[model samples]
Structure formats: structure tokens, C-alpha cells
Target: MYKIYKFDEIKNELVKLHEIDPNFIDDKNGDYFCIKDEDEIIGYALVKKIENNYLLERMFVKEGLRYKSNGTKILKFVVNHGRGKRINKIICNNKDIENFLKKYGFKECNGHLELDNIQCVNQRVTEGKKVVMSSIIQNIFLAILKITGGIFGSSRALISDGVNSLSDVGSSIAIYLGIYFSNQPADEEHPYGHEKIESIIGNMMGLFLLITAFELVKGSVMLLISGKFEATPSYITILWAAISMVVKFFMYRYKMRVGIETDNSALIADAKDSKSDVYSSGGVIIGILLSIWISPVFDIIVSIIVGILIFKEGVSIILETSNIILDKQDDEFIEKIENYIEKNTPVKNVHDVYMRKSGDKIFLSLHIRVPKDMTVYNAHNLADGIRESLILDFENIKDVMIHVDYLID
Candidate 1:
């Protein structure tokens, strides 16, 4: 991983490029950042205040890493560094560099590249769609494998697990759609964005899983009551069951990583479901082995157990999504915000810190007391700084609104 930090040392290369006076290297008026890969500084960018806004004066990547995404990383760091502020211009004549900046929400005006605040599409939407589609494909393949094996080997447990995988395909598609629509940027009609769509999809998937579980249990129970011992489960059923466990375990890990990175509730719920499938398959394997050795009744019991597990996981997902839909306040998140403000700012008191979630996005509001003699402009600036710090320091915070009050003398 590449790390970016303020550049303190004057390097010979940068001195030649920017004609820096050694004294100017540590100037407080401008911000200088160097990109370090381990201990080696591979790139640097300079952003200086030009009147009210910022100007990207010079940005460079080492010749060896010029076309290898190092420049892109540096540019992203510079953009994020000034996120709540302004980056008015970037001096880049290279067509490749210009195209790269354009992709990251920059546009050329009078031959000067400037930040364009409006984004037509979000990158998370694309990543979420890709992960969800991968889940759908994997589930479909597993469903076919287990269903065919169960039919040929006379294992009701394997068949029940296959049906669960089939249901997951439907749920994955629903999650894909939710990720796509929920990421649509906020508009006039919908001021808060469409993030709640993810919670709604999560609820629907939970209900679907409940219905699927009921059917699985019903089928297994009917077979058990009929006293039907068709035949001993074959070795092929156990083999297929083992394969399902491995596959589901890996899928769970992959989806969980992406879900956490994107903070998508629907994807995370789907990952948890995948995890349950692994345990369910493990039970199927044990039941198949026992049926081959002793009696076929074990297969029926295992199927019922798998259904119960699915129902339990479904209830968990529903409860998780319900909290988001109900706009429950996250006490831990609020406490963190209060602690941050108290420790970092000059506020005499910080109170009323609150946070709520909309899908993966967080909205925060708080009140703070500043010195009574502070100028109105300085107070407004302080509030803006606080908002900016919170948004940058914390992940997924969409906005922060702070109410400033005069402190008691």
C-alpha cells in the first residue's frame, strides 16, 4: 500500500523541478505531499493557496512509475486532501494526464483543469454490481451441482441445500439492483439520495429466505412421517456436499471483504447467508455419511436442521436491515464524534452529537460552544473546518451539520 504524507525534506529532484528555495520547502502557505511506497518516495504533489481557493502547482511521479497508476494515486490524494475545500486548477498539458483527471471529476475550462463537483456516476455502484453478479453466478453453479448430485444419489439433505442456493440466486439479483439504484446521486425530488433502497431489498431477501426455509422443512417433515427409506445415500452425495462447503466458504470470504470495503448492508447480509450455506453443507455431508452407514432417517433430520438455520439467518438479516430503515441512532458513532471534537477543536463544550444511517451513508449533526468574543466569520470558519475534518477523518459520513453557540463567560 502507498502512503501519502506531508513532505518535510528537500529532495534534489524536486528542487530542480520547482526551483525551490530551501526555506520555501517548509513554507506554511503551501501544502506539499510525497507518496511513499514503503520507505521510498515515488511521487509528490504541490497544492498552494491562490487567494481563496487552491491551485495544484506541480505533481510528478518518478519516471519508472510514470504510467503505472502512481500518478493517479497522487492525484486522488490531492483531491481528497482538499475535498471540503476547493481545487481551482491543475496544470497538465499531457493528454493522458488530462484524460485521467477527467475520469476523476475534473474538467478543462479555458485550457485549465478544475474540479467539477457534480459526479454523474459513482464508482461504488460499479464495484457493488460486479460483486453481486459474481455471487449470482457462483450460486447458480452450486445449485446445479448439488441438485444433480442429490437426484442421482437419493440424498434429501443435498437437495434441500441446492434449493437454498437457488433461492440465493434470486436474492443476489435483488441485491445487485439495490446497489445500482441506491447509489444514484441525490436529486431535487429525493434530497437524501436513494440509499434506503438497499434496506428495502435486504428486508425482501429476508422474507424470501423465510419462505424458502418453510418449504424445505415441510418437504423433509413429510418424508420423515411417510417412513420412506428409498435407498442409502451414495458416496457421490458426500463428495458433492464437501465440494459445496468449500465453495460456499470461499464465496463467503470474498463477498464479506467487498461488503465491508463498500459498507453495503445488502451485500454484507448476502455474505452472511453464504456463510450459513457452508455450515448447512457441512451438516449435509455428515448426514449423507451417516445414511450410507446406518439409516436414511439422518438425511431427513439434517434437511430439517438446515431449514432451521436458514430461518435463523433470515431473521438476523431482517433485524439488521430494520435498524437502518427505522433510522436508529448509532450510539458508538456519536460517542466517537464527540470525543473527536473535544480532543481536536477549541470548543468549550460539544453536545447533541447524533448520527443516522441511510444505507451505507452516514449523516451527522452536532452542537458546539465556542468562545463568546470570536468574530462571526471566524466562528463560521471553525464550524466549516469541523465539518470538513469529520467528513474526511470518518468513512461514509455524507454530511455534518454543526450548530455553534457562544460559551458562557
Candidate 2:
């Protein structure tokens, strides 16, 4: 919006004025003046020469200085200078600013309304489509994974797949539902979007993995204690174990490929679990074979080994997922954001940066320091620009909050 004017065409002095006060240069006849703090321009004003009166064309203080009466001081300078020039009447164009100028005896001109109806409508339509498409794709993928896993394996195996299938189901449902409600714009119930729901689902998936591990361990231990190993294992048991191993090996590869393509942690974990199942099933097959050559006790020992492996995988999944739900910060992400801000903004420094993660989404908060003499509005606009730029460049960022601070004593 600010780029509508050609800054290069104006006089260097007026260019300086426009930088200080954006509304200062227009077709109206005016003399642009800048208010300096030491060597730096902190505010700007434009006084237009009308037929018999001087109009207060425009005035603006740099963003950081607005709350310090800098605007009022600039207005006073325009009034006093106008009186000395024998200009009795002063006019102000903006109605909102007219009230502030009235204290200096300036009268308002007719109000002007700026409308951007087309832009507003287009933005809403685009946002709506994004929400709809994301939801549909996520739900479809989840259903496919669940159906495929269930049909190919037993119910217990499907359930024990843990981080792979279960995690996918949880994350997909959460993203679909979260986006549906979060895209509803701000309401009384939730001023912020429902993005955090992704984290909740991620945490739930982690817990599910833990449960799955426990059940697998319990089943393995029960087999060991039941003295089932004392009897000679049947040929059917070895045949089934061989079949399960082959199926699981292929499933492991397929799940791993999908997980890598999607960059889904849950899916990756599930893929690992499938790979582990291949080994465990193979172990069972070997244990039965060895019983014929060695002793039945080897079968019981192998079962215990499989149980321990399941327990370890469960603990790993819980730790990773819990970190995400707890909003643990990633140093790499913070460094990326900091580098972006320093490169794009006129900010002198950035500090107190905080990052929060909810599943794959990242939230950022930081303080940016600019020159001390700028007005509050200018500082705010700069912060807004930084926020907008980050969202455009980083796909995973869900929200950002910036605090503007002056770089002076």
C-alpha cells in the first residue's frame, strides 16, 4: 500500500519527507519540511499554499515517537510557521487527523473514503479454498492407510503398529478437524485459530505407541510364563511365523517410503515398528527351528528379547511426541527466523526470540530494535511487514508476534 507513490520522482528533500511522513507528497501544492532529532529526521509535515490560506497538508511522526508528543510538537511548528507567513486559515484533509489538528485551529476538508472491495472478496475466496482442500486430502490419506493396514494384517498386529498407522490416524483427524474450525476466522470462543489441535493429536499418538508396546510385552511375557515353550512347536507355527515375517518386511519398506515422502514423524516411527516386527517374527521362526536342534528354553529367551525391543521403541516414541506437545523450541528454526529478520528489516538487533512447536507447526515471538527516533506507527508497520514476510517465506510457521523497541538509552 505504501509503495503507491514514486519516491524517485520527488526532490531528495521531499523524498526524505515522504520517508518520515508517507502522506506528505501529493498533487496539492505544498512545502515539505522534516523535523530532525540531531542528524536524523524523526517526523515530517507538509504545508500547502492555497489562494489566501495555508493548508496543513499532512503530518506524521515516526512509529516509535508517536506516544511522546512528537506529532503534537510538529503540528505546533506548522501552525506557528503559518501564522508568521500571514496565512490566517489552515485546512486539514483527513477527517480522523482533523480532530487532532483542530487544537491548532485548523479546519477539516470534505471526507474521502477509500474502498478495496474487490481485493477483500478475492482474499476471502482464496482462504476458503485452502481450508477445504487441506481437509479433504488429509482425511482421504488417513482412511487409505487404516484400511490398507487392517486388511493386510490381523487386528492385533494392526493395532500394535503404533507410531505408523495409529499416529497417522490421530494426526490426520486432528489436522482435518483443526483446520475446519480454525479457519472460521476469529470468534468469541477462540480468538486464535485451532492450530494447537495438531499438537494434541501428536501427543495422543505418542501415548498410543506406549500402550501398544506394553500390550506386546505383556503378550510375549505371558507366552514365556505359560510354559508353552516346553512342548515341541508344531510345523504350522513355524509356517505362520515365516509368512508374517515376509509380509512385515514388505510392509516395512512401503511404510518407510511413505513416511519419508511425507516427512511425518509418526509414520516414520510406524515404519520402524514394522521393521522391528519383521525381526521379531523372524526371531520366533528361528527359535522354533532351534528347539528341534537345541533346547525349548531358547524360544523363551527369544520372546523376552522381543519384548525388551518393543519396550524401548515405545519409550522413544513417547519422548519425541511429548517434546512437540510441550512446545519445545528447535534451535535450527529459531536461527532461521532470526537470519530472515536481520536481512529484511531496518532493525538494528533482535532479542528475546521464543519458538513453540505444535506438531509440525511453529510459532514465533521476538523483539526487534530500530532507531529510537521513529514514530510508533512506523515501528508498528515495520513489525507488520516482518511478520508478513516470514509467513510468506516459511511454510511451517503458523503465527508470529513481534514487539518493537527503540535502540537508545
Candidate 3:
């Protein structure tokens, strides 16, 4: 039996443990453990309790102790603990971990319905719904706000509204184009598919957001320098801003909900961008009020602050889009891939595991070390099985390539 420690007790040790193996903590939930061999800690495991179910957060053996049955012992300990706690089900993230859990009687549950097991397709559908809904609502609300602003707003208010209107229109067009092109079938000219187009669109959206922020900042500075800031906003401008804030808040919530459900980067980015609009608009409203009560200079200051905030968000979106366009795999995702291979391959060792991402799709490449005396047919079959296992287990994985080599040991 392994020792089970509370999150507090294990958190400190985890810092040290991570230097040896980084994937030893559960990000979602649960207690951490250190498996000892004859009084020496050899590995670590995490058991995340989730609504009467237990998730094996992560299990890792020290590199030197990998082949010494530490992994098996950790699995046994986790399964026994789950049973003792009267938890009927245990979930694991990796396919290899799932197989190991199954050997101890865990069954594959519905991956789509369960949040912990949501597939890529399921996530995409959820995001698509959210984007569609949010886009529609935001467009309508902005149109109304523009009409109201034009009727009763000051020069500054009207100009800001114009910028916002342009941003909304550009974002809508980019989103539509992205969705259309992302779904196109692959052809000879584009073997990897059109998924990267989403990233391109996202980057373009970010660029536009940056430009909008810059313009807002520039306008505010010019207003302040020219002493054009108003001491009071018209009642209609205030009312319109209030209504816009409320509507944008709900829109943000809806889009954020869908983004989390679907893991759609584009939709998630849009949600973030939309949420920023709420904040920006809210600040503008506040600035108008403050300037009315105090001096007109406060309005320019607040607008500058809002512009900086929006620019920060734009930078974030740009960075994320850049990663996708450059085909850079997130380190955590790469680690997950390596862990999956090490645990599931049935080989003596593995190395050079590589992963790349194109939009929501994942591509993996790795080398496995097999026994020298193994038959070529058996090795080929093993490679094929490994690829198929990954495909069946992880829905986001679009492709995998496994290279086999003979191990000297």
C-alpha cells in the first residue's frame, strides 16, 4: 500500500518532485501520494475525488525505477484505495493509464457526456453553438447601441462608438470566414487540412483589437491635450452605455461557458475579447460619470487605462494565435503525450517523442526501444497497435507515427 497525503502536505514535496518528474500533480482535484519502496520514495500518484468518483490524477515512477514494478504497485494502491473509499469508478486521463486501470476492473465510461472525458468533436460542437449564439447577440446589441449613441451622444462618445462598431463588424466577418474555411475538406494542395485558417483568422482578429485599442488611446490623449473632454455625458449616452454593459456581460458569460465546454481556442479567444468589451464599456460609462461630477480630465485618464487593458488582451490573443500558426505544441500537451507513450507502449524504453498542433488537431511522433530478438512482424504489429490505441483513446490526436528500434539491454 502507498501512503496517501493531503494536498497541503504533498504540495511542498511536489515542488521537489516536479524537478524529477513534472506530471505528478493533479490540476483539477484530489490528494497526492508518494509511493515508497523499502522506506525510499520511488514514485508519486494523485487521487482526485470527484462527486463520488475518483480520478487518478497522475502516476509517475522515477526514471531509474521505471522498470522495477513501481508503476504497477502504484496502480494497485490507487485501485485498492478507491475500493476502500467505496468509490465505484476511477478515471484516468491517459489511454495507457486507462488500460492500467482497466486491468484492475475499471471500465471505459462515456467520454463525450462526461466533462472529464470530453472528446474533441464534442468540444467543437459545444464551441460552435456558443460562438453562433454570442455572435448573433453581440451584433444585435451593438447595432442598437450605435443607433442610440448616434441620436444622443457627444462627439467623443460617437467616435468611440464608431470604433467599436468597426471592431464588431471585423470580428464577425473574420469569425464567419474562419468557420467556413476551417470546415473545408482537404485536397492535394493542402494535405494537413484547413484548420490553420482558424489560427490565421484569430491572429487577424487580435491585430484588429490591438489597432482599436491604440486608436482609443490616441483619441483620449488628443481629447485631453485639446481640452475637449466633457464635464457631463448626455442622459442618452449614459443609458446606452448601461444597457450595452449589461448585454455584453451576459454575452461574455454565454461565450465563456461555451468556450470551456468546447475547448475551441477561437471561441475562447472571442469570449475573452468580448468580456474585455464589457470592461471597456463599463469604464467608459464610469469615466463619463466621474467627469460629470468632477473635472473633464478624468475621462481622458480613464479612457487611456481602458485602452491599455484592451491592448493587454489583444497581446494574449496574438500570442496564442502565433503558437498555433507556428505549429508549436504546448509543453503540457507534449508531456501528456510522452507520459502516454511511456506507460502504454510495452517497450523497454522510449525517446524523442514529438508533438505538433494545428488548430484542435494533434500530431505525435516517437521512437520506442524493443527487444533485439523480437520478430519484424511482431514489431510492426506492435507499432500499429500503439498507433491505433492512441487514436482510440485520445480524440484530439489526428495522427501518430511510431519508430521501432532494438534495445541493447
Candidate 4:
């Protein structure tokens, strides 16, 4: 089993960080984080909270994972973690990493980007047009944190957990946009309403889920091929895993509440995804801990499980949303509709009932038989009455197209 760098090994790096920013570590009183495998230390990060601002003193990943998404993930975690602390600005002097920071909505001011107004941005994203933006930020942050920890700690299981987060982030934008567009009111061109756009967007998210599943398997394969195990994953990673699990669970609850309040199925799906992440992170923690006492192979097994989960979820989402897109018939729901219509309205003998979805909104088309001798004028009036009855009875039923036809004796 591999091991992390011991205290003596990390001292040299700490000295360098001190030189770069003396305020970063107070020697007797300061904060810094180290990353390591079971064998040796692989990376370290240092930061200082200065009043309303944060200063990133130094961050480094092992040469093997350096310059890869592994390193980027760690850097992203640091940035978001700082933002989460309500830091008005984050200042970093490392010119080499400037480009990475800029890509994540950070802008250079003078020599560095001040992590200022991060709280403002987060507030706006949560409250305004970008209601789902907070989920994106969380996904990216937790994904990188786990991946960086996994890389240095040499825990394949943790990496898999991170990969799961990547899947969510990949699907989040499409899902968010779907919710946003579905909220639009019915117009001249789309009289039935814009809710269908949500269903289409949901279908697109299914594709994203599949793509991310593929990514999870690919990463797992690469790890297995290397056959390098860092046996003694650092305590830091365990701490990170625990923290991420708690945070992810809370996010699931938050999103679920929003979903219920707004009655948006797309958002509810997103919440379920977040809830799964909470458990996945829990799995990562269990794997790493078991590796210490049991056969280190537990990590690999966990990695495989995570991939399977990603694949299963992707297929399920694709099948569900695709059915709506393809207009698959739902006999059970049709029965419910028929029962409701007969009970509430004068119309009888419901037939040709059809249902499909657009976003969370359900559209129904059906024909009902009235008295064969009923007049055309009466039939038209009865159709209007049926549409009104269904609309009032079911909350999600947006519009009903009823074709009046003669009752067969």
C-alpha cells in the first residue's frame, strides 16, 4: 500500500509557502492542507482568511496528476470553498494558475483576481433567474475536492465518487435551462405552453448522463491499468469525504424543497441526483477506511459500483424522457383520466385517451361519446365543459384536446 508524505517531508513545502506569503501560515497559529497517498505526500494547499478576503498562498498536485483535470479539480475546490466562507475576494499571486481561476468566473484585477462578491453572485444565482446556478457551483466544487483527494490519496473509490459529481455537473446546465424555459407562459406559437421545452431539455440531460457514465468507466480503466495503489490514504481525504457527504445531502434537501414549492419535475430529478451523490460520497469514505484494515481491493470494487450506478441512472433517465418525446401511451393514467372525467362532467364513454409530457406539464387528448342524437351545438358546448373539468381536476394537466364524436349504441 502507498503512504502519504510524513510531517518532515511536508515541512520543506510549508517553508516555501511561507516565503510566498508570510501571512498564509503563522507557524504557531495557521492553516494548511496536505494531500497524500498511503505511501507518500503528493500535494498541498495553503490559504489565509484575511478579514473579508482570502489569500491562496500555494497549491500543488503531484507531478503525475499535475496539469490534468485532477489538479484543476483541487484548485476549483479551493476557490469555491473560499467563496463559501463569504470571502469578498480571493487573491492569488501564482501567475501560472491565473488562467484556471479566470475560467471559473474570476476576473483579474491589478495583479490578481479578488474573490470579491462571490456571495453576491451566489445569492443572485439562488434567488434570481439562475435558480440552478448554485447546484452547478456545488457540483464543480465537490467533484474537484474529491478527485484531488483521490489522486494523491490513491483511492480509486474516491475518484469514482468525484466522477459521479462530474456526471451531475454535466447534466445540470441542460436541466436548469429546461426548468427555466418550461416556466414560460403559453404564447401564440405555443398555445399549449412552453412546458414541452422542459421535457425536451430532460431528454438532452439523459444524453449528458450517458456521456458522464462513459467518462466514469474510462477513468476506472486507466486506474486499473496503472495498478498503482497508494495504500495509506491521508486523514485529510477522509475528512474531506465526510464534509462533502454532509454538504451534498443538504443540497439534495434544499433542491427538493424548491422542487416541491415550484412543482417542477426536472428540479426534483436534479434533487434526486444530488441525494445519490450524498450516498456515493459515503461509499467513498467506507472504501478508503476498509482499505486500511481489509484488502485494499475494496477501493477498486467501489469504483466499479460507482460506474455501474452511473450507467443505470443514465439509462433510466434516457428511457423515461425519451418515452415522452416519442409519445408512448400510458394506459393507467388514461384510466384515471377517464374515471375523473366521467365522475365530474356530463360526458360519458371516454375513448381514445392519450397522454404525453412537456417538461412537468402533461398534455392529454381524448374522445368521448355523448348521446348520438345530441346536436352539434350541444356537442361543442360539452367538449368545452370537459376540457374545463379536467384542467380544474388535475394540477399538472395543462390542456386537453377533446374530439366530440357520436355514442355507439
Global lDDT scores for all candidate models:
0.80, 0.56, 0.68, 0.68
**Model 3, range 272-387, lDDT digits (tens) per residue?**
87788788677777776776777767657876877787789889999998887787756787777667666655664777777877667778888988899999977886686567
lDDT per residue (tens digit) for residues 45-85 in model 1: 66675664557666667667877877776776666655535
Two-way TM-score contest, 2 vs 3, winner: 3
Q: Output the lDDT of residue 37, model 2.
A: 53
At residue 275, what lDDT does model 2 achieve?
A: 73
Q: What residue runs in model 2 are displaced by over 4 Å at the alpha carbon?
A: 1-192, 195-199, 219-228, 234-265
Error of 2 at 71 (Å): 40
**Which stretch of 10 consecutive residues in model 1 shows the poorest summed lDDT?**
17-26
Q: Give the TM-score of candidate 3.
A: 0.66
TM-score of 2: 0.54
Per TM-score, the best of the predicted structures is: 1
Clashes of each: 0, 11, 0, 18
Per residue, candidate 2 scores C-alpha lDDT tens digits across 1-409 of 0111123323545666667566655653455444455335677666666775665556777889888877776655555445446665555666656556666444333553221111123232243334334434543443344335423432222223322333334434543454344335546785554545544544554566566556666765776677664555444555555555675676667656654543344445555655766776667667667765687666556655655665666667667657765767778778878886776556659888998764345678999988889989767766865775565457566678999888877
lDDT of 3 at 10: 59
Candidate 1 regions exceeding 4 Å error are 1-54, 58-78, 81-89, 92-123
Q: Rank by lDDT, descending?
A: 1, 3, 4, 2
lDDT of 4 by residue, 91-209 (tens): 87877667766776667788676556665532312432354788889889988988898888778788778877876786778776775666666889988777766557656666676
lDDT of 2 at 353: 91
Among residues 3 or more apart in sequence or in different chains, the pairs in candidate 1 whose N, CA or C atoms overlap within 3 Å are none
